[model samples]
Target: MSIINPALERPELIAYFLGANNYSWLHFRNGEKKLLSKPISYLEGRLPGFIRVHKTALINPDYVQSLHRPLRQKMAGKIQLQSGETFPVSRRRWNQVAQSLGEHLSPGNNEEPLQESVYLDDARPTSEQSNLGRSVASLFLVTSDEQNAFLARQVITKNWPDYRVETIPKSIHLPELLDDLAQSELPVLVFLDARSDTLERLQTLQRLKNDPRLCRVPVVLLALPTDKSVIEGYERQANSVITMKEGDMAFAQVIDRICQFWLKIAELPAHC
Candidate 1:
């Protein structure tokens, strides 16, 4: 991973990745995709279970949904992801890729109608124009669950009128963002849903705790009172653990107290 100021080397900073054209890899950090100076072959060797779907693309199998074999076998197939993003599978490597994937994955039975093209609007970043992801994420909520994201933003914005919330993908997890905030002399409060955060988030949280660069950042895990992983969360060194109780009133109270304590009462670290 390329750090703007080269003192830190954080490979764990990226969320997911794929090769981009300019001898660089599209590193999705904190769900916002950015280009990094890393070769596709290098990533393929480094990441276990990462499948070479295309000559240019090496996909992490944990994120793979299906590699759809096309009706017209002359053209290449497409590899769809759980995030509803799809990339073309190279025709030359199709057989080898299929063999590696095994049965029950390919020749998708629930053939969803394909869009105009395999390329998505979101993928065109870096290759096309300049993006302001960090500015947009200034007051963002990183989560995979649409309902939780909506509800959290609703509560946060209604109470804090000056803040505009951006609901971001939880896949973008790690230190580059924290590094940016730290450099800017700014403090960011992150709220992770213990049950609802993505499968990748557990690993993300572990790395967050271990990385000294992010030790000062505040991370709050909103979990149910009965959650077994609540113990593991504290072990992971989360700054605050908010127990979500039952009932709407209880939920509202928890949110209120969380905002009150973090925003009003507690003395946060001096980022500036």
Candidate 2:
């Protein structure tokens, strides 16, 4: 029973042993416990903002104390935890992990200062982009897996380029994240990954959709390959449903389409 302290910037979460895989077992944590019979890969896109620090650990950057790039050749850098547990950071994800932590520490520093541009693309109007410059869109993604959240961030960085992206794993409670989202003035987009069969996922979605306070903010359901058939059910409640294979282009297209729709509605003539 490892307990996370409150002084640490990371959220307090618990991990339940889901089952055993070849290398690692599945885990889910909130205030209480729930185990899964599935593999960790099945929860990849489902956990928001979490990253696989080691074969057995999915950690939220908030709880990370520091990154240790050891001089030893065989060992990669490790992410030190407040609990004193060091999770190995793979060579492939070193840069990405560092960048994500850097961005979190220094917000609004990555993008070029918003400047006036006369040039316009055929797909969107100059005024549209200009307006977008004036307003910021912060997409807060919630998934059950860190890798998938990073994937979403990569797609967003490649396509939107102008917006900011942050991810949190499902290990943190949905209510807590929603509270933070409500505090932010920017347009908040919540991407929920369909991973766990736990009632929390469905219950949270239902509550958010029905809550008048949160219903207007866009919520996207990221469906797994196996969950394709259930997407239609979510569409009625979610602003959009995105399948895993659709990739970045398709995901960006969906974001652009929704933004355009919102802009049109906002700019509508009073008489109409």
- Top TM-score hit: 1
lDDT of each: 0.53, 0.47
Candidate 1 lDDT over residue span 1-272, tens digit each: 34322311344444346554445454443465656566667666666566776556666665667766643322345667767766665556666666666643556532433222211112112211222332211233455556556566667656754434444455332343343333333235666666565345555566667767666667777666765667767878877777664333444345556767877788767554
* Candidate 2 lowest-lDDT run of ten: 113-122
Per-residue error at 20 for model 1, in Å?
A: 18
Relative to the true structure, candidate 1 has a C-alpha RMSD (angstroms) of 14.1
Q: Tens digits of per-residue lDDT for model 2 on 182-247?
A: 234324566666545334555667767776666666666766555643664374487666555433
- Show where candidate 2 strays beyond 4 Å: 1-135, 181-186, 196-198, 225-232, 245-272
Per-prediction TM-score: 0.48, 0.40
In candidate 2, residue 88 scores what lDDT?
A: 47
> Which stretches of candidate 1 lie above 4 Å from their native place?
1-41, 44-140, 162-164, 171-182, 185-187, 197-199, 245-253
